[model samples]
Target: GAGLGDHIDRKEGQEHTFQNADPARRQLNQSFAVTDHCSKPLHTAISDRIAEGYTGTTAIRKDAVRALSLVFTGTHEDMKAIEADPEKLQGWLKANYQFVTQEFGKENVVRLALHLDEKTPHLHAVVVPLVEGKLTAKKLLGNRKDMSERQDRYAKAMEPFGLSRGVRGSKAVHNSEGWYLGQQQQAQKAVLSDLPKLTALDRINPARYEEKVQERFKFVSREKTDTAIELKRRTDQVRHAQASQHKAEQEAARHREATQSIAAQLLQAGKAGITLDSSYALLKAPAAIREAANTLFQEEVRKLADTHLKQGAEAYYRGIYQLEDSSKATREDYERHQKHDSEETRNHIAGEITRIFNQEIQQRWGVELSPEASLYKELRKKAADLVRELAKTILQELRKALGLEEPRQQRKSRGLGR
Candidate 1:
C-alpha cells in the first residue's frame, strides 16, 4: 500500500501533488459509504470496518491484504462522452457503485468515490475482501479467469451508457471490428424499444416508424456480415499461430536427429581419421597434414560439447520432475531453476572442457605447462566444451564389464517418471 494511495489521495479530499489533479474541481468530487459505516478520511474508515469484519483467530499481520481497491473507468473517448453529459455521468457513477456492491457485498464495501479532478472522471471503490469472515485476497480477487468474468459483468452494467468492454491491448481505432457488433446491438435494442409503443398505436405514424426500422434492420444486417468476417479472420489467425508452433516443434525434433547423426559421424571420424606423432613430427608435417590434424581435434571437442549440452537438457528435465514429484512446483520455480542452473551448467562444462583441452595442448604440443598465458585464454574459450569422448566410452565399457555401473533409464523429461 506504500505507493497504492497516490491515485486515491484525491478521493479523501487531501491536497493532491499530482500534476493531473485539479484543485478547483476537487470540491466537485463526491464520496459515499455503501452502508454509511466507512466514512470520510478513507484509510481510518476502512481499517475500522476490517477490524469489525475480520474473524481470523490469530492477530492479522501488518502486511496482510485487508482490502481490494478497484478503479472503474473506460477508455479516454468513452469517459469523454460520459463526462460531457451530466445525466450519463451520474448514471455511470450509480451503475458502477451498484455493480461493486453487488459483486462484493454491501457489508464489504468501505467507500465509493467519484473523482472529477482527474483528466478522465472515474470512480474508485474500496472493498474489504472479507470472505466468510477471513481476509483472503485470492478468494475475492481469484485469478485471471475470475477477473475476466468481472469485466463481462461490469461491461454489461455499463452498456446503457453505450460503452463496451475494451480489448486488453488494442486501441479503439484498431478495435473497430469488435465495436461493429456493439453498434448492431445498440441499433437492435432501439428498435425493440419502439415495438411495444407501436403495438399501442400511440407511437409515431406506423408508416414512418416501419421505414425507420427497416433502415436500422439493413444496417444491422450489414454489421452482422462484417462481424462474421471479422470472427473468421481472427479464428484463422489463431489457427495460423498454432500451425506455426507445430512446425517449429517439428523443426526442433529434426535438428536434434541431425545433431545425433553428425555426432556419430564425428565419433567415427575421430577413431579412423588421423594418427599423430610427437610435437616434433606434427611440426615437421606438411601444411595439408597439419590442417587435417587440427580438423580432427576440433571434431573431437565438438562431439564433447554436443554431448554435454544433451546431458544438461536431461538434467534440467530431471530437476523439473523432482519438483513436480514434491507437488509444490510453480511456474516461478521452474523459471528460476532454468535461469540459475543454466549458468552453473555452462561454467561447470566449460571448466571441464578447458582442463582437458589444456592437458592435451601441453602433452601433444610438447609445451611445458604455462596454463595462465594470455594465449591460452582465447584458446580455452574457443575450445571450451565437454569431455574426451574416446576415454569416456572406454571407461564406460570397463565399468559395464566389471558390473560397477547399471544401465541408466531413458533420458527424462518433465513430470513424474520411475
Candidate 2:
C-alpha cells in the first residue's frame, strides 16, 4: 500500500527510479500511451478516466484498485534476441497490448512504456481495472487462484510467441516489490558476511592493506609497460615491410618504362630503313641489333635489382632505428604517467593497444595488395617473348630474301626427327 505522500513528488517519465538503470542507455527508452500518459502519472491518467466513465454512483473506495501495474520482460539474452528483431519486439508488445485491452477494455489500458535503460529489455504497463462498469481490483485479480488463472490465460495468449507460464502451484508467497528488493539486499549481505569485518583500528592501520594495493598497482604498471613496448615493436615491423614494398613497386615501374622505351627504339630503327647487314649496323645490322637488345635489357635488370635492393635494405634498417627511438619515448611516457598509481592509466594503455591493433594493423594487413608489380612483371615477360618472335620472323624473312636455305646439318636433323 502506498502512502498519500507517495504521490506528492511522483511524476511520469521519471524512469531513473527503476533499478539496474544506466543513464547511458536512456536513449533506448520508449514510451507509448492510449491517452495522455506523458503529462500525468499512470494512476491519475488511467484510473481517473475509468472512474469518470463508471456507471455506478458509489464513490470509489480509498483501497479500491487503481491501475494494474505489470512488468513484462525476460532474461538478458532473451531480451537481446528480441531487441535484435523488430518483428519479435513488435509481436511481443502487440501480444501484451491485446491482453491488456481485452481484459481491461481499450480505454482502461492507458500507459505502456518500454524501458531499455536497464540490463534487459522490459515494459511497464498500467491497466485500470474496470469490469462491467465497476472499479474493483479484487474481483479481477485479488486471490492467488485468480492470479494464476490470469497468468495461464496470458501465457496461452502469448503461446504464438514461444512464451510459457511460470511454474504453477509454486509455494512462493507474493510480496511487494520493495519487500522483494529488501530481501535480495539481505541475501547479498549474508553472502558477503563470511569475510572478516574490519574494525575502526584496522581502517587506519597502513600496514594491513596498503602493501597489497601498492603491489597490485606495480604489477599492473609493469604489464602496461610491456604491452606498450610490444605494440611499438610490431608497428615498426609493419613500417619496415611497407618501406620494402614501396621499393619493389618503384623498381617494377622503372623496369617496365625502360622496356617500353627500348621497344620504341627498335620500331624507330626499322622505320629508318636500317637493314640487318646495312651500314647502320656497328659491324652488320643483324648481329648489332641482337647485341643491343639483349645487352640493354640485361643491364636494365641488373641496375634495377642493385638500386632497389640496396635502398630497401637501408630503409628497413632505418625504420628499425626509428622504432627504437619511439620505444624510448613510449617508455618515458609510461614512467611519467605511472607515478600516479591510478586505474585510469592502465585502462588508457589497454584502450590504446586495442585501437592500434584493431584500426591500424588490421587495416594495413587487410587491404588489397596492388597488382601493379605482378602486372608489370607479366608485361615484361610478354615483351621479351614478342621480341624473340619478331626477331625470329625477321631472320627467316631475310634468309628467304637472300635466297638462302636451311643449313644442311639442320635439315638432316629435322629429317631424322621426322
Question: Which candidate achieves the best lDDT against the true structure?
Answer: 1
Q: Considering summed lDDT, which 10 consecutive residues are worst modelled in model 2?
A: 1-10
Query: In model 2, where do residues sit more than 4 Å from their true spots?
Result: 1-16, 37-39, 173-178, 181-418
Tens digits of per-residue lDDT, candidate 2, 255-302, equal 676567546657886786644332232233344354564455445444
Candidate 1: deviation at residue 26, Å?
2.0
Superposed Cα RMSD, model 2: 33.6
Give model 2's TM-score versus the native structure. Answer: 0.39
Candidate 1 Cα errors over 4 Å, as ranges: 1-17, 168-418
Kindly report which residue pairs in candidate 2 clash with one another.
Answer: 276-285, 276-286
Can you write out model 1's per-residue Cα lDDT over 318-390, one digit (the tens) per residue? 4443442323445554445445445455555555555655565556455433468554564455433332332
lDDT of 1: 0.62
What does each candidate score in C-alpha RMSD? 22.9, 33.6
Residue 41, candidate 1: Cα error in Å is: 2.3
The local distance difference test score of model 2 is: 0.54
Candidate 1 TM-score over all chains jointly: 0.39
